[model samples]
Target: MTPAPLTRAAVADMIDHTLLAPQASPADVDALIVEARKLGVYAICLSPSMLPVRAPGLVVATVAGFPSGKHHSLVKGAEARLAVDQGAAEVDMVIDVGAALAGDFNAVLADIITVREATRDRAVLKVIVESAALTDAAIVGACRAAEQAGADFVKTSTGFHPAGGASAHAVRLMAETVGGRLGVKASGGIRTAEDAAAMIAAGATRLGLSKSAAVLDGFPD
Candidate 1:
């Protein structure tokens, strides 16, 4: 079948409305959930402590290892299980970027497998590769690890990295590596409609955006 034309709503559905700031409070989370519902985005991505959002119509996603993938595999898995128990429908785990950069694909695979086993089918698993911090080879290897370990998505960044966030090149490379076997999420620094669309064009099936309202407003019909 021919692909359905990408519409404003179609793009909106691809969003994981995010609020991963260090200072975000319960009040802020409440407000985010309310706004997410009004905007009709796919999910609300938050820090694990803010879980159990209870947004009836929206999916709830939370981060595991977060911006830093330095946490031990056992710790990451425990964190993910906690988030899932707290009602997060999805868990975005950070892989050991240092390991990937060092060409240690075994360590990377082990990291993802840890969380994958913890989450099982209870929550969708997304492995954040911090792509901006990796070389082209590392990015490809990271994506391959995620797919091999059964991650549902391969994300580009944590938005907290000094190296910056998602880029079209990384997203395209990730897509090419996974070959539709996994989804690609372009996050961090994606603040404009054009940027979001470009990531999608490059084969991103999902987006993580903290500025959902503004980006959605800028999206063309």
Candidate 2:
């Protein structure tokens, strides 16, 4: 489907400029904020410990339970609360992929709800379903779980998974499932402007990019 190309400002507003590396230091986060400001991106995503990223205009988002969603729900909730307390404006929590894979949608919903309530509307709660790792039905089921759990957004991948990262197919399915009720975030391995555009066309409301500046540089003014 050929969709309209987004204007620079629109594209900027859709980005979550990210730096989720394991060894990322405070200095790197400072640098990320500088880049985010220069690029006019909407948010700067980081690890939970890198919270309180006082980037005046940018939304500060952090990950909970990280690349693996194996952590218990309570543990993830506590982690999210801590990040929020540290000044994160949004929290991206990983769902237990195994539970979803096992056809246990109930567990998945409960797990996400735990963190959602912990966030308590203080921050946007995005649930990462690791789309690259699941079958289509599982993907749909997972998105439903996020919606039922009252998550603010449904995300594609963690970028740390060996399986791979976001794909246009995943984003389209997520958008179709959620329609207008919940937001969809297409993240991981998105390296260029065309990649960003494709996700947007697929109905993703947000784009997570470690290489946000470079991608934005390729967009037309």
Candidate 3:
């Protein structure tokens, strides 16, 4: 059976409209909220510091462990707990890429579990796996660890990593690893409608994009 063509509204609903730049000011986040509302996005992803923001009708997501996943697991858990307390409905926590790369999925699972316990059902948890920096085997391992740790989603990248961002192959692998049990979020460096469509076709259930309006504009209504 052929799949239906993706519509602009459908794509917008899949997007986590993002503004995670380190230098972004409170005013910039305010502007991002306005843009997200206008674009009809599902959520707005921001730094944890930007929490307590109001994006009525849109899910508010914040990051823990951030661009680098080197933080101690306890610290990441605390960050997630605090963000949830501050009104963030979702938390994307970065895992230690080094653990995955070193074939230590047990450590990865433990790290994610800490954050999962901290959120305690108050927020949806997405694990950022830094897929671009990992080998395909590591990606699979990381995704499996995320699932075993009870994350709600497994995200591709943080967009700040020097290596790269989301790709169709990574999204596919992640989706297959979780096997419909968890959402696959294709994030980072996705700037065009074509890119967004490809990720969806590859089994990404969610998207993370900094250029939400431009990408949505490229799609037909």
The top-ranked prediction according to TM-score is 3
- In model 1, the Cα lDDT at residue 204 comes to 96
Clashing pairs in 3: none
Q: In what order do the candidates fall by lDDT, top score first?
A: 3, 1, 2
Residue 214 of model 3 has an lDDT of: 90
CA lDDT of each prediction against the hidden true structure: 0.93, 0.93, 0.94
**Residue 178's C-alpha lDDT in candidate 3?**
93
In candidate 2, what are the lDDT values of residues 1-221, reduced to their tens digit? 76566777888999999998989999998999998998899999999877776889889999998889999999999999999999998999999999999989999999999999998989999999999999999999999999999998999999999989999999999999998799999999999989988998899999999988788888888
TM-score of each: 0.97, 0.97, 0.99
Q: Taking the tens digit of each residue's C-alpha lDDT, what string does model 1 give over 1-221?
A: 77765677888999999999999999999999999988889999999988777789889999999878999999999999999998999999999999999999999999999999999999999999999999999999999899999999999999999999999999999999999999999999988888988899899999999999988988667
Clash tally, candidates in order: 0, 0, 0
For candidate 3, the TM-score is 0.99
| Model 1 / residue 128 / CA error / Å | 0.2
Residue-level error in angstroms, candidate 2, position 141 = 0.4
Candidate 1: worst-modelled 10 consecutive residues by lDDT: 1-10
